[model samples]
Target: MANKNVIWCDEKTLQKDISGKIYVVTGANSGVGLETSKQLIKQGGHVIMACRRVDAGEEEAKAFGDLKGSYEVMKVDFADLQSVRNFAAKFKAKYDRLDGLMCNAGALFSGDQAQYTKDGIEMSIGVSYFGHFLLTELLLEQLKKSAPARVGILSSVGHAGNAKNRYKVHFEDINWKNRKYNGVDAYCEAKVAVNLYAMELGERLKGTGVSTASVHPGWARSNFGGSGVMMKVLRVFLYPFRNSITNSNEESAQTSLHVLLSEDAPQHSGAYFSQHSVLYRDKECRKGGWPMTSPNPHAKDMEAAHQLVKLSRQMVAL
Candidate 1:
């Protein structure tokens, strides 16, 4: 069944009538986020680059001049709960409405060392799940104001079954005090949780026209794999495979734009998609192991999502 109705976005086609629309892009200083912002501005949308380093964001925003989509550099560090809070507060005060929020920031580590966030959760969970959780909730009212607002999460296919990520969330032991930390696998868990949260959020925002969709940008030759002596060896030795299998930043950014702007996206809220089309995962995803909206073979844990919200509130003291 070759479907021909799919509309894939091309970065070069920088001509969308998004003028005056407010768009918030997390981690907009580099990689796909930067690329995505460039195209957005070129097309006439107002872009607010939410970044950890305000200076870097300013420099990048300036590079695209008389930006069809006037932009400003806003500070937001996903690792720090306080920072996420500050960003949301400032954003709410500044923007009357939000047209789109692109949760395009994520990272990967190679070691099994357990890292904790300022909020006391595993480092991966904090930035990828809890932090975004708080940010989205804070700006939810703003999204409502924008009605027809969209949320795009940059997810990865790696969330699929892997020996490292099979840990059934021991809700009682989310801190990993009982299980040894596998950084890579822990990352997968957080991303899976993001998709699940999207499901719950979809139900909440249904009539408001606030849509949420997750995206897998293939692979990109980016700062995804942190640099270190060990990673150096892996990057050099595996350079051939990584380069060949991964996508360039240019091609990868379009998927996010497609989701944020395409007509098909809003109607398909709560589902994951890539390369501009809906993605259907195995039936296992419906079983109760992972959270809802995750393609993983797990049941949608509505309770867990609620619990996660409670935990985040306590950790950030929000």
Candidate 2:
């Protein structure tokens, strides 16, 4: 259960001067990624907007024209593993240090039917998990060079379970090649993989001064699921309660910002955070009756994380 009374931080609460810091944000054209980039720029951090559409990224970059920090648009289509490699190569060629990498870009519905990437993996898992996995791996040296660096993966509460389904990663059918396809389930599985990846990465980088964490930004009114029929149906069904539960893009970007800039963040390496608090593996209640964030059991399973990493490396031929 999530605490409805959680105190949410905003751009005004961020006061860190990240001057000379270089950060990368995927999907920086819209939603939480865009807002996160804005806040980072305002805090004097140079940002690289890694987007699939260079035109859209360049257009969005104009909004930060008068901001304290600057941003450059780079083309990166996560659906294609080769594009991810190219983006990382171009980044390495220009910059020697990477202070932060926010794996924020993700896909939800794949229209009326299931889809596969160029590499023959499920679209959702391929882009959301494998793509980010490769990018992070390619940039690990830079992140290590800029020790004390951070990597934030945008996960979701849906990874824990939906209102009617208890989501779990199906190791046997990780790509849904032999199983029935359900967009929501596939998305949940991908998020779970991301959380596990972050946890494992944090463990590996423990003494390297690089920290990794996963974040549930909470539901926001964004084009996340795209304008698909299913998304339209969901929007209509949840319309009555949208205002009470959904967060604004700025608000949703807070938790990630907190992990990236807060003084207390590094201590919680390998953790899942929501509403600025560490989400434990088991549910706990505060003295004031507030529900502390709790990650699903699968997200905390170290053995599963290791297995997934091994499988992911094999899938991407790393």
Candidate 3:
């Protein structure tokens, strides 16, 4: 199901000039994050590349060539809450406004044992969901000050796993403290949290010029998911048809670009977007597939979304 009903987006989908606009992209030193930042810069937009490794980010930024827009690298480790807060404070102090914030950094753990972040929270949920939560919470005011700003969250089709029951959040044992550690399930649940957060955040921000949405970029080949045995098996399985089955980094970035730059995206603010052609923006800039409902019923649970926000605030000490 993850492979079906998806659209393949290209450069033609987004041709608008965004000169002078300011955006912050997490994990921007590589993969989809790098591609997204490159395109935004090509369109004359200013980008703040937030990365765990500042040196790596600087190295990549140097290779961007002479582009219409510009970029600067900042450091933030999603595994550490203090780092996220520090980045937020520095950003607000340096920039007058923020037009967009892309919560694009993510990680997957396929090892047998559970891993933890610097804060002791489960690694997958900690880095992929909680850090971004704290960053967005801290930047809400700046986004409001710069009305018409947007938050684009990068989700995954794995959120709606290939399992028969789909995926559900384990609120009672969110940190994997009580259950057998399963890395894939942990990743899926973390993604579900982000999607739910986008839903609830949209509801709370109504009438505020800032809007939010979550997107699923079709499975793209990258150095993500690590080199655990499970991942190796998956790679070997997909290697035969990886080209036909997976999207390239540039192609995977289309959905994110469309959601952030499309003029029609505001109306669909609480929705989930997938990589299917049906959800793409057309030549006239009208909505194609978005406002697309998430396949997971649990992701649509408004009550759960609210509870998640509450728990997240407590976890991040917000």
**TM-score per candidate, chains pooled:** 0.84, 0.89, 0.90
Tens digits of per-residue lDDT for model 3, 70-186: 999999999999999999999989998999999999988875688999999899989989999999999999899988989989787777654366677789999898889988889
RMSD of each: 5.1, 3.9, 4.7
Q: Where does candidate 1 clash, by residue pair?
A: 219-247, 284-297, 287-298, 287-299, 288-299, 289-298, 289-299, 290-298, 292-300
Give RMSD (Å) of candidate 1 vs. truth: 5.1
Which prediction has the highest lDDT against the true structure?
3
Error of 3 at 74 (Å): 0.5
TM-score of 2: 0.89
Pull out the clashing pairs in model 3. 6-276, 6-277, 7-275, 7-276, 7-277, 279-289
- Per-residue lDDT tens digits for candidate 2, residues 1-318, read 334544455444497789999999999998989999999999999999999998998887787768899889899989999999999999999999999999999988554467888888899888889999999999999999998899998887767773345566688998787877988789888988988898899999999988888887767667788887778999999887665566677767877887787766678787877643222223341111111234467767889999999998998889
Between prediction 1 and prediction 2, which has the larger lDDT?
A: 2
lDDT, model 1, position 122: 84
Better of 2 and 3 by TM-score: 3
Please rank every candidate by lDDT, starting with the best: 3, 2, 1
Clashing residue pairs in candidate 2, if any?
none
Better of 2 and 3 by lDDT: 3
lDDT of 3 at 174: 90
* CA shift of 318, model 1, Å: 4.9
